[model samples]
Target: MSPATQAMQREDTQNPAMLWIANGQQLWHTAPKDSNGKSCAACHSDAKESMRSKAAGFPRFSAPAGKVITLSQQINQCRSNAQQAAALPQESAELLALEAYVALQSRGLPVSPSRDPQTRQAAARGQKLFTTRIGQLNLSCAQCHDNNAGKRLAGALIPQGHANAYPIYRLEWQGVGSLQRRLRNCMSGVRAEVPPYGAPDLVDLEAYLAQRAQGMPMETPGVRP
Candidate 1:
């Protein structure tokens, strides 16, 4: 295998985010009284059976929302509607674990984000967002991750903005987070005020990232520096 791919593999094995995934597995089977006394397993059966190869497609256009939605958003929706559980705050351990578990189901599947009309439009918007300068730094995501990918910035190698692997354990964050959350971190890095989770702009950006990684295999539960 090429060095970069080999390095990425090594990173995954060493990722601490796997611990959160393990936690999520435990949570999934734990019954909650507030959830109508139901466990996630009740409706989903086995996580492998119900969710296998499912997370490979994300940032999907939700007809109900009239916009693209990330995998994390969908998990929250499921918690509210299917599991009868209260929606946890975004970036919480409960949400992260659930997302990690779902993402793991699609491990090794190719990212197949939609090409539907809505998604296409969202992707277009996202591309613009990627290149547009935002925040106090007046820098775009491409400024580092794209234009200077593989180069060093303050002692870190800039990745090529690949979102195929997500629900990753980031050493910096010291926890698991979604690609969208990472996008927000970039916005913050540039001193830009981040939009709310599930915000249209962020959703579009996710759609664009997933579409860019069209044929890339899903590496959910990835570990990143």
Candidate 2:
């Protein structure tokens, strides 16, 4: 399901993820192992001032990788090079909490997908993937998310394949990161052969999702079921 569908409207004062956000705030300011001994705050102090608005613009292309990358991947990369901390495993609590923290920083900002011509082409490629069926079940993403949106599958409402809030703490996965992980789950559920992470198709698909979510608020590391 899309995060939009997963999101339960609530008073900002009663947000459940607020505690995790506080944890993230502390982690950002607290120094890590002394090997480098530099906190994320040491270099980038004040997330609200330095990182808040920036969180709205992500899942963007990276010149170094020559492909678009998600926010968590970027954060792990920074932790490795900047803080000398080992890369947090995917779905790990550290990663999830951090993702939630960063996402919460941009709670009200609008999502901005890439607009470069290259981005459009990438999104087009993703659209093709969304509509194509390449596995034993012969079902496409459109089968459930697009065509069957709002329908129930195993008691859960199928939602539009929106990528507005990612790196979410899903009740299923119980961790946080890009929607690609969820995509892989959907492919497996449909008896499809899942591609390796960071594959070309997934990159294209990410581009496509970013475009689809254009102008929607980015809520990362969100909680969902």
Task: Determine the C-alpha RMSD for candidate 1 after optimal superposition of all C-alphas.
Answer: 2.6
TM-scores for the candidates: 0.89, 0.83
Encode model 2's per-residue lDDT on 81-125: one tens digit a residue: 788888877656676667778777787789877665666778899
Whole-model Cα lDDT of every candidate shown, in order: 0.81, 0.73
Candidate 2: which stretches are off by over 4 Å? 1-16, 173-178
Which is the leading candidate under lDDT? 1
Worst 10 residues of 2 by lDDT: 5-14
**Candidate 1 TM-score, true structure as reference:** 0.89
How far in Å is the alpha carbon of 112 misplaced in model 2? 0.4
Question: Which lDDT value does model 1 have at 160?
Answer: 90
Give the Å shift of residue 39 in candidate 1: 2.4
